[model samples]
Target: MTQTVSSTDPPTPSSTRPITRPTVVGAWHDRFEEILTPEALDFLARLDNAAAGRRADLLAARRARAHRIRHGEDLDFLPGTGSIRRDPSWQVAPPAPGLTRRRVEMTGPVTRRMTINALNSGADVWMADFEDATAPAWQTVIDGQLNLLDAIRDRIEFTDDSGREYRVVEASQRPTIVVRPRGWRLCEKHLTIDGRPMSASLVDFGLFFFHNARELIARGAGPYCYLPKLESHLEARLWNDVFVQAQALLGIPQGTIRATVLIETLPAAFEMDEILYELRDHSAGLNAGRWDYLFSRIKTFAQRGPEFVLPERAELTMTIPTMRAYTDLLVATCHRRGAHAIGGMAAFVPSKADPQAAERALTKMRADKDREAADGFDGSWAAHPALVPTCRDAFEAVLQGRPDQRDRQRDRQGDGVAVTATDLIGTPTTTPPWITLTGLRTNVSVSLRYLTAWVSGQGAVAIDSLMEDAATVEISRAQVWQWLHHRVRLAEGLVVTRDLVTELMDHEVELLHAQATDDRDHRHVDEARDVFVETALGEELPAFFTPYAYVRYLVDRPLQPAQRPTAEDLRRSEVVRGHEVRSEP
Candidate 1:
């Protein structure tokens, strides 16, 4: 087997191998020690023996709870969620998963043309979308969003510069059309179809996503979503719970929906598996959001450190290596768990909108397709209708020449697993496709343009300290620590960062084997000890404990509606007012 690389594309080495593995996130170390203290474990042992009889009821209750969850009879409904929050309520158990599992792919303006061309060109599980694809806008945001999706879902066609007309297959043939609404922060500005107001919170975003879910699903589309700008597991859990409630309200089957969370946020990086675990019942897997993730890293670390600001339109290679490493990690992490690691959105190529730029853009788009495929991405997104064919062809070509089936020798360890084939060096490797080279170019553009915004930690996480803001650091630490705990191997009978730690986490993580080790807890411990419930051991902590800031919001506030002008109110003013006053007929 060989590690494949495009002749022109470069490779990025990942430190996920070691060196950057933090012993602990600093804050968590104290808690880990406080709970697992010698005195606590002894107390538990004595209590366990004394309460052995009570264990039966505990086991019975646990089984009953699982049964309720599996049956969907216990769905917890919260209205604020279905409207703006986009969160799903997983209170009711999800039914058996669908046989035809699906993963939706997102495309940006750069690759939209090529991606659409490809969707029409072949059969894909779904062509995911981005409200994040364009510049932020509002005032009928719902209508505008629906229009974009509706247009894409129909028989859309595009023409390339060389007089090549690409008419993609109707969504009927492909059928799955997924549209991800704008996330919480930007959602305050969006309005509903009835021109209603929207809230600015995650719960509100959940409600918005939930309310619209029916419309998207009603038109021969199974409900699906791609989570973006996510901050923590709590955020995902919020979405899961909101979704459950939304379905119940809409009269849909309990678990008829599905989702894929974009692991673009740096803090979301280390906690990839945990986030998915929270949404495992409905998860499709994950994607490494290049532009946003890199942007986020810079915002957290560079802005304040540097005296001068970056250029308006800088070069794109600055973060390619990191992006590559991120994608590699995402793919490895997902595949390790038998899930698909969808590739990043392509940045450029096929500017059918401007004939003059089409040639240059097409070249870049195909290159990105090739690179993404080479990086082990199952598929990538296309922004334009014209780009679809190229993107689709590129994916088909990469997979066509590869193996049809994969072996489950180790039973793929975690959230996902990318199937690999032999490469020139006799090393087993998985890449998206050489076709995605253009994405590198796009990534560079997004990196340079947004680098400043990201470094300032201006996007989502706002708090920062000496190294990174407290929130960003916590999020990052969660992922890193969790991945390490599950994938890394401390020597025989060794403890996690035991060399650096005055503490040890004896959790079993053998189940999350793909995390770092090929077997029992390479990154940290066996899967059996994979998770840590703060509440389960809450009393054990040095005693002062807050569940998590985000968790606090989930428990206390239900998603709610925000302020917005009525149709009559807007019509009598501004754009409409001017047109009316002019009396143009």
Candidate 2:
């Protein structure tokens, strides 16, 4: 049902006229009240009012495009936007303060301790992620905003249960804060303007910009962001419009806001030049959001055939042809436009309990960073603060006193690097190696572990010496679906049928139940099992698991009655606006 705000609603009273209050539809906690102040809600409403319709249109367009692809449509760079791509005279706005030296950036959830730790982690930039790294619970959303606010003011601090203290370090020692808001597909149901839910993207960006944009400017930094899950240049255009309007509304300069987009989706990969062109005025650069990109590839090409069926997630390294093409194109495109081409995440988490494992993990991380640096990427992401120095040293080896290699154009004539649409597609000609039992078990374990924490409002968790986030969960579940659909054979020559998958899922659930140490853990494990089964084994693939799991498990709401709607109820329902009414004799 679609709910529209009525035009006849009462206007803001004179006392609250300057900053109109919004109707918050969900429960309000103590700290939530601080973040959702009258002015902040009003600001969010303004953003929603301006961009909500266009967001809806673009989301509909996304569905249409996907539908066309399913009907055998091919994807290539848009000829419509060719002029924007071919224009050689244009460049994005220069890197904003603190963004110039993003040689090693750290990413994590915006929890209090994480905010402090990431800022003090000695990386060049800290991406305070509210998207994939966050679960989007109401309290989490509000608290993340509060944490960022406190971090900005240098008042954030925390102490562990073991009595270890944490506090923001001296301003000079801290990493520059770059906030990543939720994507366009999510809506903040807790807050509604005019009966319709506001975009979560707008809400996160709105609250943060309202509270901190001016302060950041005063601190010699501007409101910087990492845009995620964009699938087209239209989406980038929407964000650029939002930035321009936001700066105008907040009295900041037009170009004060800078954004680095995550070219994560398959479609966005084709529109690299256009994506940068759309946001050129506010563009910082682009990052190779590797995991999600792979997930997107599987999702987009799932039904195409065996050629698109990916190998085990562990086996598909960045050096693979498809990945190399994408990264090469990204670096080439960014350098051509004078933008930084940041690399993918090194998600290895060192273990304190095992020296050998820690050494191996560090070695792997160093190698990954070395490849990214050698490939002409300006910087890369580290999932843990401990990996920062390894990333820094790797980049430092090639950078040699340079902040970035934006001047190193990879696509110049005689550069010996050539990337084309065909290269980007890079469909495998041979079948992938058989799925190993260990690989299958790893998928089940990691997905279950990650989903358990996710349902409990922890979006980022360290599992088996690796940091797992939503992207990891996506990859795991998508692999399960692809394997099942393809009836993939294991090394033992046993096929992955429904029965086998169900048996393994049940075994994993039992293992988790056995390991549960508390009621909370037990409940979360149960929910995780359900989430995994439904998302991985449903008749049709779900576009995303988070939205369904979010409403079912995360939102703090009362259960609805199970009664069917009556004729009178339907007649009077505001949600039935678009339906035709008829009287029966």
Candidate 3:
């Protein structure tokens, strides 16, 4: 059942030396050979050999820092990097082509349909998210690369089960593409190097950069990227080095790869200036990754005290004092250094079933985008195409034909944005008794349904009109753990305990079954429940639920050749690229 794809390697100069090829442990899908070519695999192997050790060291440093924080070490700005912050003369590199006017960027997974829809959404930039918005099934990983390649060449198309067609707009009309690879902590278990799993970050970035860097440059856009889950400036330094080596090895000009780091972690927020300094030569800007920021806040200080107990996820918004402080500091820091300060995702998806509810959601979304535009943010993100115009209009009102507002020096003009370390970490700003029965139920319902869909290969699920991704799910589960750890009692006089959570989860599962129209919905509910109990109800709070759940549930064996089909594999058949095939027969 072992299948290997063969294709000619890209022509290498005679001066180049051979590289050890990384083993492809995943199954081969149709036309996957186009992307997993010999030269491409070699490129990934070389990049891994160069930076994998540094990546591992930084991840270990992250764990050590988290351990220290939980054991009573206070989190604050680094005293060592004060010189980088105080020095006013440094600035990030100017924006590359297709990145300067990112006023209404659309964010979605790189699925074929979603990819075409996002590029044609009329947004200034389309972030093809391979992290939160994508469930990293092996087929999904390879298929996404193929879709990107086809889209860039203007040959991508989609026909649904009913034969309805989907096509991308002309190349001139499409939004600029920016890829968000997997974070440093995750591993591409299917791709091994020296008998160890390759860093998923490098696997994703290396594959895309090797195949598309030249084509994208010829199209007037370079290999732009968005780095996620960065915990420190050192992580940024590692990525910068990777970019440098990537461009040099490929013979593309240095500084052609521009990256926007997501300042989602609490430690990253403190080291913003130093991070920009580290990647300043190839920096696009920083994003106010609000959802993961909240998750980080809870995870970092959950064991310390009851003071860090967070309210419900819905109750924590951009208006909260701490969140406001985070955004203000981000905008100020980015604007101070002449980088585009992009805002966070607007997760509302216009409800097709209810017009009134849709109107309300749009109104809320508009207000959020308007506030961000007023706060000196150059642009923001929308989860759906319908929400793009709202985001665009809000920024347009302030931009008035200007590409960005990076010229506004919000850091120098006001004390309102003068955020301190205490302002960033001081939580429960509102009154106590924040946890409500509705909040607890909402968390349970979201956890069950989202995880169900996630295990079934859908990373971005629409739950109660919001586009729920890994970041939002992380926030939900983290809140549950924080509440349980603090013994939080709702206003209804019900204490959050293992028994109560189990009861609620059972009830939610019943409701999900009743609402299920087919077996697809029921197929993964039990697995999702197992994941929820393990991650949310455990004694120790796990930093993320994805790594554990992914390894346990989503990893599958490679597909057999098309001609060989066993009865077991036939029972587990799936529709891949319009063909009904047994994945592991």
Best by lDDT: 3
lDDT of 2 by residue, 1-585 (tens): 211112223422212213234588778777787788888877776776567656765665676677667667777777767677677888988888989898999999999999988988999999999999999988899999999888999888899999999977799988888999998877676776555556789988999999999999899888999999999877887898888879988888888899999989999998888888878889999999999999998888776666667778889889988898899889989999999999999998887789998998798889988999998999999999889999999999999999999989776334866766777777554774667877887888889989999998999998877888899889888888888887888887888888988888888889888989999999999989988987898776667777667766776654211343232321121121122222111
Q: What lDDT does candidate 1 reach at residue 278?
A: 62
Superior by lDDT: candidate 2 or candidate 3:
3
Which stretch of 10 consecutive residues in model 1 shows the poorest summed lDDT?
541-550
Worst 10 residues of 3 by lDDT: 1-10
Q: Write the per-residue lDDT of candidate 3 for residues 1-585, one digit (tens) a residue.
A: 211111122321222233468888887889989988999998887887667655655665676678777889888888767788888999999999999899999999999999999989999999999999999988899899999999887899999999999998878889999999999878776777554667889989999999999999999998999999998887788788899889989998899999999999998998898889989999999999999999999899888877778778778889988899899999999989999999999998887789999998899889999999999999999999999889999999999999999888975337677788988997443344468999998998898999989989999999888898998678888888888887888989988898888899999888877877778777688778888887899888878887777666666644222333332222221111122222131
The clash count of every prediction, one per candidate, is: 142, 1, 0
lDDT against true structure, model 3: 0.83
Expressed as tens digits, the lDDT of each residue in 383-490 for candidate 1 is 344556677666667676442111111222233432221110012114211212232222222222222222221222111101111222223233223222333222
How far does residue 260 in candidate 2 sit from its true spot (Å)? 0.3
The estimated TM-scores of all candidates read: 0.46, 0.91, 0.91
Q: Tell me the deviation in Å of residue 202 in model 1.
A: 6.6
The better candidate by TM-score, 1 or 3, is: 3
> Which runs of model 1 end up more than 4 angstroms from their true locations?
1-130, 134-137, 145-171, 189-197, 200-221, 304-320, 351-361, 401-585
- Off-target runs (Cα >4 Å) in candidate 3 are 1-19, 412-415, 427-433, 515-521, 558-585
